[model samples]
Target chain A: MERTAFQIDARDNVATALTELAPGPVRLAGDGEAEQVEAVEPIPRGHKLAVKFIAEGADVVKYGVPIGVATADIMPGSWVHLHVMRSAYDERSAHLNLRTGAPEDTRYE
Target chain B: MSRKEIPSLEELRALRWRGYAREGGGIGVRNCVLVIYTVKCAEFVARGIVEGCQSPDVQLVGFDGCTDSQCAVNLLAGLIRHPNVGAVLAVGLGCEYVQPERLAEIAARAGKPARWLFIQNEGGTLPAVERGTAWARELLDELRNTPRVPMGLSDLTVGAECGGSDFTSGLAGNVAVGRFFDLLVDSGGTAIFEEIVEAVGLDWLLLSRAANDRARAELRHAYDKMIAYCRSVGQFSVSPGNFAGGLSTIEEKSMGAIAKSGSRPIQGVVKISVPPPEPGLWLLDSTPDPNPVQYGITNPNDSEGLMDLISCGAHVVLLVTGRGSVIGSPVAPCLKITGNAETFRRMSGDLDFDASPSLTGELRQDEVARLLAELIAETAAGKPTKAEALGHREFHIPYKYQEKEARRADCERR
Candidate 1:
C-alpha cells in the first residue's frame, strides 16, 4: 500500500504528508506501528500534520526535536504551520511595521 | 546496514587515476593554469585573457575588495598553490592592496610557472588584454609537459555542501552523501562538512559523535559561538525558499542539513581555511575565527562556501541541492546531486547524480551510498562534472570587519 504520510522519527509528534490530503481520516506509520488521525484541514505535501494532540505552549516535535511551540490548542490531525505554531527561537510577532521594523500591538495575541 | 557489502580498503585503493604530482606530497586531479586578478579593477582584462586562451583547463578567479586583507591574501595564495594548478598568471591594477607580484612570487616559490602584468603599467585595458592573453597561452604550453603520476583514493580530500535545500535533501541527497563519507573515512581519505550556522539545533547530537574529549569541547564551543554570532546579528540561517519548500524553522532546516556528515565520529574541528590535522571526518568551522565586530549573519552564498572547502585542501566537492544550483568552483570540481526527481529531469544538464531513488523507495540508503562512491571514484579519475562541462566557474569573497578584541569578548561570553 502507498503511504500518505511519514513519521520521520519514532519520538515525533508530527508526520509529514507524502501527498496533498483533503480533510478526512489518514493513517500515519513509521518504525513499525500505525496510528490513525482525522485531518482537520487540507495538508499540503511536505507540510506537517499533528499526529498527537498538542496543547497551547507545548513543543511541536518533529525529527525527534522541538521545531517550535504551539500558539493555541492543536488537535490531532490538524495542520501544523505558522497559523497555529511559531518558531521557538523567533519571538517577534508577525504583525510588524516594515518601515520602522517594530512589532505592532494587535488583537488575538 | 551491514559491513559485509563494503569493499575492502585494498580493493578500493585499486581505483587509481593519472594526476599531476605536486612538488610537495599531494596529487592534483586537474593540471590547470590559473589567471587571477589582484582586485576587481583588473577582472575584465583577466576575463579577456582567459576567454582568449579558450581552454577549460585555464581558469579565472579573484577577490573584489581593494583593501589589504590578510584573509584575502591567504585565500589567493592557497588557490595559487593548489595541487590542481600547474601554474598561475597574476593580473593587477597597480594601486590595489593585493599586488599581483606577491601572488606570482608564491607560485614561483612552489616551483610552478608564474607571470604577472599590471594593467596600469601595461598602458591600460586593450594592450594589457593582448599581452595577458599571449602570456596565458605560454603558461598553458608550459603546463602541458607537467608530470602525471598514479593517484588513488587515499590521496583525495572531499568536501560536502548543501544549498537551495528542500525536504528531499535530508531524506535522500544528504543521507546518501553521509553514507559516502563513511566509506571514504573508513578507507583512510579525508572528508569535510561545513556551515556551522545550519548546525544550530544539532549541537548536542553532534557533540555526542565527537572522537574525543577535546573534540567534544571544540564542537561545543564552535556551536556556542555560532549561536551567539547569529543572535548578535538578529538572524538565523533559514531562508524563505527553504520555507516554501516545506521547512518551517531554522531547527527544522538544520535537522535536514546535518545528515550530510553521515554517522562517523567527528575527528575534530578546524577553523576556516585550515586543513584537518589527520585524515578523518573534520568539521570546517566557517564562523570567522575571532568574531569580527561586524559580520554578515546569513551564510555566504554557495561559491564562498565552496572556496572555503577548497582552502581546506579538498580536491573535489559534493554539492547537494534539492532546489538545484548550477555553480562550480575554479580549482576544485563540483559534483552536483539532487534528490528531487522532478528537479533532476528539469536540470539534467546541470546535475551529475540523482539520489531520488531513495525518496521513491526504489533504493535503500546504502545502495545510494554505493552508487555515489562509484560516481566519486569516476570523478576522481578525471571525469568532468556537469558544471565543469557547462563551464560554470563562479567565485565570490565576502567582506567582514576583522577585530581581535571582538573575538576575545565572544570567547569570554561562552
Candidate 2:
C-alpha cells in the first residue's frame, strides 16, 4: 500500500491526514485490507482520521499518544470534530473511565 | 532487576559537548554587536546609524515596546547584557519610557561600552542619523580595542519557536527540538520559547511540569490569560491547519506544540521581557490580545513571534515548521528546521534542518537531538543558517488593547 496517512508513532492507532480524503471507498495503509468508512464526520486535511473502529469512550490517539477521549461512538474514517472531543488538559467535564486507562481525576473535577 | 536509567548529566554532556567545551560560562558561536533601539520611535534613527557605519560584525534590532516605560527599560538593559552582544548602542526618542541614558549606564556597568543618539536633542532624523552613525563608529572602535576572549557553551541562550505549523510539527520537528532544548537546559544554558497563542491548550500540563508550587501557580495564571485572550479572538486557539490535521481542541494542539519543550522540569514563568535567571524550562506569558478580531494582527505569528523571544534577550532562535518559512532576524540567527520530508524536499532551499526522518521512525530521538545541538553550536560560531543566507529581517507589532478583559474571559471560563 502506498504510504499516504502519517503514522506518528508505532503505537498510534490513527494516522494524521496530510491531504484531503475522499469518502466511500478507501483502504488504510499497512492494514492491507479494503475497509469502508461512515463519513459520519468529515475529517479535514492536516486532521486525524481513524484507521480502525474506536469505542464510545476510547482514547483518541494522535502524535502516537492519547490526545483526547471520544464524546460519542466513532468508526474508522469518521471526522473527529471539536464537539465530539474534549480537551485532555483544559476541558473540565471529560469523564475519565479508569477501566480504559483514562485519568481518574482531572484538575477541573 | 530494574533496567538502568538514562545516562547521567556528566555522561550526556561529554557525549555531546565535543572537544571545544568549557564550564561556568556557557559556550556561544557568534560574538554579535547588538545595536538596540530603546523605543519604536527611535527605530529609524538606529537603523540609519547601523546602515551608515555598516560594519560586517554589527547588526541592528529593536522592540515594539514603548507604552510601559519600566518594561522597555528592563528589556533594553537585558539585550545589552546578552552574551552574544560584544558591544551595545542604544538609540531613543528623548522622552520615551526607556531612557537611552539609563540603558547606557546599565551597559557601562556591565563593562560594555554604551552610547546613544537622541532624535529630539539632535535636531531631526538626518542630523540624528549623522550623529548616530559617528557615535556608532566610535563605539565599534572601542569594541575593536576590547579583546575577544574565549567563551563556553553555558553562555548560550537558544530561544525555540515555530510558526506555519501542521500536524507533523508537534510530532516530528517540535519534539526533536524539544529534546535538544532539554539538553541545552541541562547543560546550564538557557532555552526559551514563546507565542502565548500557541501555548493556549497546554497550560495545565505545563503547570504539572513545574518543579515547585510557585512555578505551577505562575504557569496557571499565564496560561489562563493565554486562553482568555484566545477566546476573545473568536477563532479557536487551534488553527485551521491544526483542525484539518485532526487535532480537535486547543489542548490537543498544545499537547503536540508543547512537546517541543521535551521532558524538562518547569523552573519558573516570566513575562515577555524577563528571561529565566538560571537554567531550566521557563514559559513566556504570551496571551492573545482581548480583541484579536478587531485588531486583525494583534497576536503572535510568524516573523513577529521572534520579537517576543528576542525581547527577552535570546542569543539565537530555533524556528521549527512543517510548512516552510523563509524569513530570519537581523539580531539573532534563526535556524529553520522543517518536519515534513516532502515539504523539506520541496523547500529544502529555505530550511536548515530536516526532522522528517524522526517522524518516519528512521532516526532515534537522541541522534536528532545531538545533531541539533551541533548545528546550534555551529550557528553560534558564526556559521550562517538558511535564514541568515537569505537575509530575513522580520519585526514585531506593538501591543494594542482590543476588548474588555472581563467580558472576554467570561465566555470560556473553563
Candidate 3:
C-alpha cells in the first residue's frame, strides 16, 4: 500500500509524514515534480522525512521558511526530526521532554 | 500544495449579517450587560448581581488588582467600548484606584447605558447586590431594542490566535486561516493576527510582508522588542505538547504560527488595547515595554491572547488549535477550528470547524476557507459557537506595563 507525506513547499527538502511510514515508496501530497520519494526508514506520523539530500549545517526548509539547520548530513527518505535538526534561535528546544514536551527545570508551585 | 489556492474577492465580500449597533461605533454580535468589578474586593457583590439575574444576557468580569495599571484600565475600557457590550455596571470597593464612577463615566462617554456604585457605599454586599441587580435588569430590558444594522465583510474586524499546535496546525489549521485572511483583506475587511512572540527567527520574512515602508519599520521594531523580551523571560511560547505533537523548535512553530496571518501585506503593528488604526492586516504586539524593571506580559495563555484580540475590537475571533482547546472569549464569539482530523473527531463537541481536509490534499485551501467563512457568517448571525454553548465565557485581564504613563498623567491633570 502507498503511504503519504506532505511537502509544505516546493522548496522544502522535507515532508511531514501523514502516517507511520515504513521503508517504501511514499506518495507526495505537496508541490513537487518527482511526485514521490522512497522512504529508507520508519517515519512517525506528523514527523518529517527528508525529500532531498541536506548537507550538514544546511537549513531545513518548511512552509517556504527555514525552520532550523541540519546538525549533520541527511539523505532523502530519512527522518528529519530533532536529532537531525536543531533550532538556531532557541537552544532550549533540544532539552524539551520527549513525552510531555516540558522544558528543563519546569516546576509547578 | 500547488500554489495554495485562495478565495476570490467575491466570495469574501458576499457575507452579510445583522448585529446590534453601538452608538459610538462598531457592530455587536452579542448584546450582554456586563457587570464589571473594579477590584478583587468587589468581586462577590458583582458576581452576585450577575448570578441573581440568572440571564445569559448579563455577564460578569472583574479586575483582581488593587494597584493602578494603565494596561488594565485600558483593557477594561476597551471591553466597555466593545460593540458586544450593550450596557455596563461598574462596581468598586471604595479604596481601589479604579473608581466605579469613573468606569461608568468611560462607558457613558462611549454611548453605552452605564451605572456605578461602590461596595463600601452601598452598605456592602447585601444592598449592593440588590441595587446592582435592579440596575442590570433595567438596562437589560432597555437594551432589548438596540437597533440592528446590516454589516458585511468590510465592516468586520476578525482576529486569529493559535494554541495547542501540532504539525497539522501549520499544514492545515493555520493554512486555512491564512487563506481566509487573504480573502478578508482583499475584500477590504480587517484581519488582526497576534502572538508576536511566536514570530521567532523569521524577522526578514515577516518584514518583507509589510504593506509599506512605515509598516516594515513597525514590524521590525516590534519583532526586535519581542525577541529581546523572549530572551529576557527565557521562554519562546513553545509548549511541551507542541513537542510531543512533532514540532521541533520555536523557529518551526513560528513558521507555522505566522501562517495564520496569510499572505496579505501587513498594515502595521498594533499594541494591546489599541484597535487597528485603519485596517488591512494589522499585527497585534502585546509584548511588555522594554524596561529594566518590567518586561511586562505578552501572552500568559490562549485565553489572554484571545482577550487581547477581542480588545482590539474584533467582531469574531478565530482560534486554530492543532491539539484541541475549549476556550472562548467573553466579548467576542470565538470560532474554534482544528487542523487535526482525529482531534476534531474526538473533541467534536468542543471544536467547531475542521481544516484537516486540506491536510490529506482532499480539499483545496480556498474551498475550506469559503466553508469557514460561512461559519463566520452564521456566527455573526448570532449562532453560538461550541465554546459559547458550553458557557466557556473565559476572560483574563492581567496587569501589564505599557507606555501609557504619560496618558495617565494627562488624565490626572484633567
Candidate 4:
C-alpha cells in the first residue's frame, strides 16, 4: 500500500498517521524493517502509531527527541496516544482527546 | 538519525535582490507613504487620504486611544520607521496624547518625507482629506524614485509567527520555517520568532538555545514573566481545540509550535516596537506590561501578531498555519504558508506557499525551506505576496498599558 504515515527521524519510535489508518500493512515514509508496520487498530489522522515495539516506561521519540513515554508496552503499529503513553513534562496531556484535540476538562459558561 | 538537508551560508549568500535602502542602515522591500491617525476621531480623515490617493502604495494605520498608552505610541512610532514604509502623513484631532508631529518627525528622522495635520485645525473632513491626499500622492510618486540597492540575506529581517496549527504544521510548516530561519541567521540575516507564550513546558529547551549568557538571562526573565503572566491570567497557551488537531500535551504542542525558530542560538528577548539591536535569531516576548491597572487583553487576535511583527521592522512576515489563515497586515507584506495539502488546495488564492509537500515525503524539509527562502527573496524584489496582492492590509493597535520600553509580540491572554 502507499505510505500513509511519517517518521521525522530514524530514532523516532512512533510515526504520525497522515490519515485514518485501518488495520493493514501501513508503510512509513522511509524503508527498512518495521518501516512497514501494521496498524494494530484504527488510528485517526495526525495521531501516532508505534513504528516499533515501545516497552512500558521507555521514551517515545519524535523529531529525534523524547516527546513522551509509553504508559504500557506497545507493539509495532499499535496506536500511540494518551491511553498508552503520557507526557514527560506536561500533566495536562492526560486530559486531551485524540480525535478532536479538546481537553476533557474544558468547560464553557 | 539520518543527516538533514540544511542549506549552507554559501547558498544563502548566493541569492540577491534589489531593495529600497533606508537612510539609517536598513532596506525596504516596499516604498509606501503611510497615513497614521493619532486619535479615534481622525481615522476617517486618515483613511480618506488613503482611499482618495491615486497611488496604491498609500497605506493607512492608526491608534484609537484618546489618552496616552505609551505602548500605542511606541508601536505607531515603530511603524513610521519601518523599512517597508518610505513616507508618512500623520493626522490627528490634536487632542490625543500621540502628537501628530511626533509621528511625522519619526519618518523625517528616518530620512523620509513627512507631513502632519489635525482634523480640528483643518476645520473638518473635506479640507484635511484633500490636502492629505495630495501630499500622499506626491510622496508615493516621489518614493517610486527611492534608490534601489543590492541586498542579500544579510540585509533582511524576517519574523515568524504561527496560528491555527495542526499536526502538519509542526511536522512540515513550522519545521521548514525553522530550517529556513537557521539558514537566514547563518547568512547574517535577522530572524525574529514570536508567540513565545507557546513555548510552554520547555524553558530548558529555550534556555539551552540562547546564543550567549546575556541571552540566557533574558530568556529566563522573559520565560518567568510569561509564566507569571499566564498564572495571573489563569491561562496556559494550549486550548481544547489544539487537541482536535492532534497535539497531545502542552510540551508536545509547544515542541511543534517552536519548531519555526530553528536550531540557532537565540540572540536575546526584545519587546514589541523594539527592533533587534543587531542581526541574528531573536525571540520576541509579547507578555503585557506590568501595570497596576491592566486595561486590555493580550494578543487580541492573529492580525495583531502580524502587526506587532511589522512594528518591530520585519521586512516580510512568514505566518505558518496548518489549518490556514487569510489575514494580512499594513506596512510589511505577510506570507501565509501551510502544511495541510487540503487547506492549501482550498485556500491557494490566499496562502503564499505550501510546505505540505514535505509532509507526504514528496520533498525534504530543507528543500521546502530553501523554496520558502526563495519566495522571500522574490517578495523582497517587488513580488507581492498573496496577502499583499489580495489587498489584505488589516491592522490593530489596542490601548494597552505597556511602558515605552517595548514588550513585543502578540501572546494571547487566554
Report lDDT per candidate.
0.80, 0.64, 0.85, 0.82
Please state the interface RMSD for every predicted structure, separated by commas: 6.0, 9.7, 1.5, 2.4
Pick the TM-score winner.
Answer: 3
| Candidate 4: C-alpha lDDT | 0.82
Model 1 agreement with the true structure over A14-56: per-residue lDDT tens digits: 8877677778877675531557667888887767788888999
TM-score of chain A of 4: 0.85
Tens-digit lDDT string for candidate 4 (B291-405): 6775666677788888888888899998998887888888888999998888899989999888987777777778888888878888888898888887888888887766534
DockQ scores for all predicted structures:
0.27, 0.21, 0.69, 0.44
* Winner by TM-score between candidate 2 and candidate 1: 1
Q: List candidate 3 segments past 4 Å from native.
A: A107-109, B1-12, B404-414
- For candidate 1, write residues B129-231 as lDDT tens digits: 9999999899999888888898777778899989999877876899899988998898888999987788867888999899998788878878887787787
lDDT of 3 by residue, B19-77 (tens): 89989988888999989998999999999999999887788887889987778888888
Worst 10 residues of 4 chain B by lDDT: B405-414
lDDT tens digits, residue span B265-301, model 2: 8777666556677777776654433332334443546
RMSD of each: 4.5, 8.9, 4.0, 4.4
Among all candidates shown, the one with the greatest DockQ = 3
- Candidate 1's DockQ is 0.27
lDDT winner between candidates 1 and 3: 3
- Greater-lDDT candidate between 2 and 4: 4
3 versus 4: better DockQ goes to:
3
